[model samples]
Target: MKFICCGNKGSMPVNDNGIPMDTKKETEAGEPKYGLGVRHWQTFLYFFALTVAYAQRVNLSVAVVAMTDAAAANINFPEYDWPEKTKSLLLSSFFWGYVITQVPSGQLARKFGGKITLLTGLSICSVLNILTPLFADWGGWQLVCALRVVEGLCQGVVFPSIHTLISTWVPPNERPVLGTCAYTGNQFGTIVMLATSGLLASSSAGWPSIFYISGGVGCVWSVFFFIWGASSPAEYKRISPEERKMIELAQASESTSEHPKEKLHTPWLSFFTSPAFLALIIAHSANNWGFWTLLTEIPSYMKNVLGKDIKSNALLSALPYFAMFCMSFVFSAIATLLNKRNCISTVVSRKLFNSLGLWVPMCALIGLAYVDADQSNLAVILLTVTVGFNGACYLGFQINHIDLSPNFAGILMGITNCVGNIMSIIAPLLVGFIVTNEQDVEQWRIVFFIAAAIYLVGNGLFIIFGRASVQPWNDPPAKHRRNSTPQVESQH
Candidate 1:
C-alpha cells in the first residue's frame, strides 16, 4: 500500500507521473468538515454483507449438532439419526460447490462490476438459506447437502467480488485500515452466529429459526445494497468531486490503464509461475486447514470431551471469534502505524505479522492437544488466544494480493481462495477419518498436531519466498498489451 503525494498546478493537482488530478480541496468546494464518504459507506455495506453471508454459511454447523443429538442440546424437536460420517459429509459439502466457482466469479466481477455480481450472488444465497429447513426436513441430510452446495456456489463469488470492490474503491495508503476493517466482518459474523445459534436450536422455534432469521436479514441487506452500492468511484453518483479525485489519484500510482475498468488479459502463466503467488497459496491453504478444522469440529469437542450442553457450547465457541474480531482492529492499526512510519518494509511487515499469526496458533494448538479433559477452562482460553492472534493474518498474505497486483487482485484472490478452500473440504473429511471417537482426547491430539505441523511448514515457505512488491506482469510492454476495451463496452 504505497502513498501518493501530489503537487498543485493552478486549480488542479498533478501526480508524480504527470497525470492531472481533478479533485478539489474540500474547503474551497464547500463540503462539510467531516462526514462518511461514499467509500466509507461502501465499506460498511460490504462489512454487513460478509456478516450475513458467513452466518448463513456456518449456521448449519451448529444446527447439525442439535439436529443429530437432541440430548446434547437438551431439546427434542425432531432429531435425526445421522452417522458421524454422514454429518461430516454434510459439513464439507458446502465447499464442494464453493471451490468450483472461485475463478469464474473473479471473471464475473471483472466483467459485470463487483456491485451487481456480489448483490446477485448474495440475494440468491439468502433465498437458499430461507429454503434450507424445509429442504432438510423433506430430503434429509442428502437434500440438505445439495442445498448447501448451491448456497456455497453463490457465496463463492463473495471474497473475489470484495477484492475487486476494495481495489477500486480504496487507495493503497488506506488499504491496511479499511481493508482489514472490512474483513473483520468475517470474525464478527462468525461470533454472532455461533453465540446465538445454540439458543435458537434449543428454543421453541428449534434449529429452523437460525436459517430463517439469517436469511431474512440477508435478503433485506441485499435490497439496500442493490439500491445504494457502486462498483467503483467512477460509477458512484453521489460522491463529492474532492473525494472522488483523491481516490483516483491514489489508484493512479498503481493502475496501469487511464481507466482501470478497461478490459485486460489475465496473466495466468505468470501467476502460476511466481514464487510469491505460490507462497501465498500455501499460506492460504494452511490457514483454511486449521481454521476449518476448529470451526466445524469444536462444538463436538465441547459436547463430547467437556460435557457442555449446546447453549454453553455455542457461547464458548464464540469467545475465540470475539477475540479474533477485536484483535483484527488492533493488528491492522499496528500494521498501518508501522508502515506509515516506515518502521519496516512491506515484505518484512507481511512476513512478521504472518509469522506471529500462524506461529502463536501453532503453539496454542500444541498446548490444546495436551489439555486434560477436566481442564475445559484452559482449553477455552487456549482456543480464544489462538484465534485472537490469528487476526494478524488479515494484514499478511490476505492483503498481499493487492500489493502484488492491484490490477488483478480479484483474480489472484480467486485462485488462492479456490485452492485454499479445498483444504476446507478436506479438513472435515480427514477429521472424520482420524477422530472416529469424538470423545477420545488422544485422537483429537492427532488432529491438532497435523494442523500445527502444516502451519509451521506453510509459514516457513512464505517467510522464505513471499513478496509484496508489484509484479512486472501487472503492466506489460505496450507491444504485448491486449485490450478488449470495446468488448466490455459493447456488452455493457
Candidate 2:
C-alpha cells in the first residue's frame, strides 16, 4: 500500500532546475504570501479524497478476516466461506477495472477538468462501497469481484486526475510541500482504516459495518469536494486576483505562452519510447508487487501465522502505515531543506530518495524472511521501517513526472500507472499461487524473497537511467514560434 504524491510548478515560481525561487512580494497586508491562495485548500480536499479512496481500497482486506468462515472474531456473523484463492481474487479484483480507465481518465480530466473526473469517480466508488455487502451476500464471490472491478475502474481515474490538477494549479515551487502533504493522506487513511476495521468487524453489527462506515464517509467527502474542488486556480471562486495572476504568469513563463492550456499536448510516440519513462514504469511496477503483497495479505499472516487474535491483528497490521504517515513529514522536510540549500541536484536528490525508499524495504523484506515467527516484534519493526522509508518515493520518481513534462504529466502517469497496476493484478495472483498454504512460513519466505529481488532490480535500473530534468519532447511542438521561449526549451 505504498502510494505516490505528485508535484509540479506553481505561482511563486521556480528556476529551470525545479527549485523554488523567492518571487514573493508584499501583499496589501504588508506580508509575503509564498503559497497559492485557494489552491492550498484545493490541495487539502484532494488529499481527503485520496484518503477515502485508499480506505475503500483496503478495508476489504481487514474485514475479510471476519468475512470468511475460516476465521472469526467474537460474533457468529454471516460467512462467505471463500477459500484463499478466492480471497486473492477478491483483493486483486479492483485492479482490473482500475487498469481499464487510466489513459481514458487522463484524457477525460484534460477535456472536462479534474474536478469532474475526480468527483464522478469518487461518487461512483462510494455508492458501490455502500452496496457491496448486499451484493456480496446475494451474488457470491464472482459478484464481489465484479463490484471491485467497477470500483477500481472508477477510482483508477484518481491518480492521473490528481496529476492533471496539480500541473494546472500547484506551482512548481510549492509542489514538494503541498503536493506531498495532500498525498500523505493515503498513509493516514490506511493507518486509520487498518486500525478500526477489525473493531468494526468485531462489533455487534459485524463486517457489513466496515463497508457502511467507509462508504458513507466517502460519500460525505464527495459533497464537499464537489462544492470546493476546482481543476485549476483560475476556476476557483474565492481566489484573489493577485494569486490567480501569479499562477497564470508562472504557467505562462514555464510554457512560453499567454495560454499555456492551449499549448498543452501529449506526445504519444515519444513517451512510449522514453528510456527515462521506462525506468519509472519498472520502478513503479516493482514497487507495487512488493507493496500490494503486504497490503493484501499481511492481516491473514498476522492472524494465521503469528497466532494473533483479531484485535491485535488489526492494530499490528496498521502499525506499518502509522510509521509511514509520520515519516512522510520527515521525508518531505528533508527533501525541502536539501532543495532549498541546493545541496544536491534534483536529479541526484530524486534518485537518492527513490532508491532509499525501495532499497531499505528490500533489506527489511529479507530480514522479515529470515526471522522466526516467535520474533514477531522484530518482524513488525522491519515492516514499519520498510514502509516508512518508502515514503521518500514521494520526493522521488512519484514527482519526477512533473520534472519530465509538466503539461503531459497526467498522460504520462496514466500510462505508467496503467502498466504498473498490471503488477497489482499479478501480484495478488502470484501470492495466491505461491503461498497456497497461508500458515506456511517457507511459502511466505518465498514471497518476501521475490519482493526483495524486485526492489533490488527495479532500483538498480532506475539508478542507471532515471531523469529529473524535462525531456525535449515535453516542449510545445512549435517551440520558438510561441509567445515566450521556455527556459528548458530555449536551449534546444
Candidate 3:
C-alpha cells in the first residue's frame, strides 16, 4: 500500500499488490468522496443521541444540589433537607438499574438491531425525565431515587447499542475518528448539563426546568432518530448504493454476507480467562471510579469546600467536561494520523494513549487533594486539565472491544460496562462514608487519593495485558472458517 498525505484528511493509503487499503473501505475510486455521506450523517445522529441521553442522565446530579440546599436556588423554590448520606443514595441509585440491563441489552441489540433497542430506551427515559419533578414533589427523595432507577434501566441499552451500530456502520479505516466523535457526546452532554443546570435551578422555573429541558430535547432527538436512523448500512434505505457497498466491504470481516442477521454466540469462558479482556475490565472499572467520583461529587465539593454558589459551582464544574469534549477530537485526529503513517502498532497506540489518559488524572487528583478553599482557581484548572487529557482513552480501551471482536462488540461493551458501572454505584456510597463532613478538606482528600490509586492500578494492568489485535476466539471455527475474516489493511 502507498500512503499519500491528504492534509487535514490525514494520510489516504491506496491499494497496492493484491491487498485492499484503508481508503478503499469507505471510498472506491471514481465514487463520491466519503465526506458527509449518509453513514456520516448516521454517526452524527448517534453523537446527538448520546448527548441527549447523558444530559438526561446527569441533570439530576446538578439539580440535586439545588433541591437539597435552599440557598442553592431561588428562595421561592422548594428545598429538601436531605442528609449527605441520603443525597449520596439518590445520586448512586441510577446505577443500580444501570448495571442490571447491560448484558441483556447487548443481546437484545444483537438480535433485534441497535435502532430499536436504542430508541426504545431513549423514549422511555425521556418520559421518565419529564415526570421527575412531579415524582420528587409527590414522594420526596425516595420516589426520586426510584424514578432515577427506572430511567437508568431504560437508558442502559445506550452504549451497548451504540457499540453494535458502530461496528456495523463505521468502516475500519474511519472507526477511530468517527467512533470517538460519536462517544464524545458523553462529555458534551455533561458540559451542557453542568453549565446550564445551575442557572436553570436558580431561575423562576426552578430546578425542575433542568429536567424539563433535557427531557424535551431527548424526546425530540428520539423522534428524529426514529424517522432517520438505521441500525446498519443495510437498513438505511436512503444510503447511496456506492456508500453502502463501501461500508459493507470494510465490515466484511465482521459479517458472513452483506448483512448477516445471525445472533452472535458469546464466548463467556474465553472472555473470563483472556488477560486482554480482564485488563479491559480493570481499566474500565478504574475509569468509572475516578470519572463517577469527579462527576457526581465535584459540584458538592465546590459548594461545601470552596464555598461557591450554585451558579458558580455549575459553571466551574462544566469547565472540565468542556475541556474533555474538545480534547476528544484532538486525540482522535492524532491517533488516526499515527495509524495512517504506520508510526506505531495498534497495541502501542492503545497502551500509550490509555496511559496518558489515566496517569495524568492520577497526578491531578493527587495534587487536587492538597488544594485549599483559597486555591479554588488552581483546583478548577487542575480538574479541567485532568478530564481534558482523559479524552485520550477513547482511542485506548474504549474501542478495544471492537478491536477484539467486531461481531461481538456489543456483548463485550455490555460485559465491561456492567463491571464498570458497578464501580460507579460504589464510588458515591464510598464517598458518603469517607467524607462524613463535606466541608472537611482532609476527608475529601481521602476520596481523591482512593480514586487516584485506582486509576494508577487499572492502567498498570492494561499496559501489561491489553491487546488491540483480534483474538483467535473472535471468530470461532464452528461459526466462521479460519482465515475467512477479511482484514481491512493490517490495522484491523
| TM per candidate | 0.91, 0.90, 0.91
What lDDT does each candidate get?
A: 0.86, 0.83, 0.86
| lDDT-based ranking | 3, 1, 2
Tens-digit lDDT track of model 1 for 1-492: 432222234444444433343454344448322234567678888899899888888888898999998776646576889988999999999999999989998888988899988999899999999998899789999899999999899999999999999999987876777888789889878999999999988888888898999999999999989877889988976577788977887788786654344456677898899999999999999989998899898888888998898999999989999999999888877876787578899899899989988999999999999999999999999999888899999989899999898888888889999999999999999999998998999999999999999999989999999999989888643323246575554443
TM-score of 3: 0.91
Residues 1-492, model 2: lDDT tens digits: 012132335455543433344334555568455533466667788889989999999999988778884246645677877889999999999999999999998888888888999999999999999998899878988998999999999999999999889888877777777778888888888988999988888878788889998899999999998877888876865566666777766566556433355345567888879899999989888888888889888898898778787889999999998888888789888877787667888888889989888999999999999878888888889888888888888888788888788778887888888998998999889999999888889999999999999999988988999998878777655334456557755543
Whole-structure CA lDDT of model 3: 0.86
Off by over 4 Å in 2: 1-36, 74-76, 257-263, 478-492
Worst 10 residues of 2 by lDDT: 1-10
lDDT of 3 at 365: 93
Residue 228 alpha-carbon offset, candidate 3, angstroms: 0.4
Candidate 2 TM-score versus the reference: 0.90
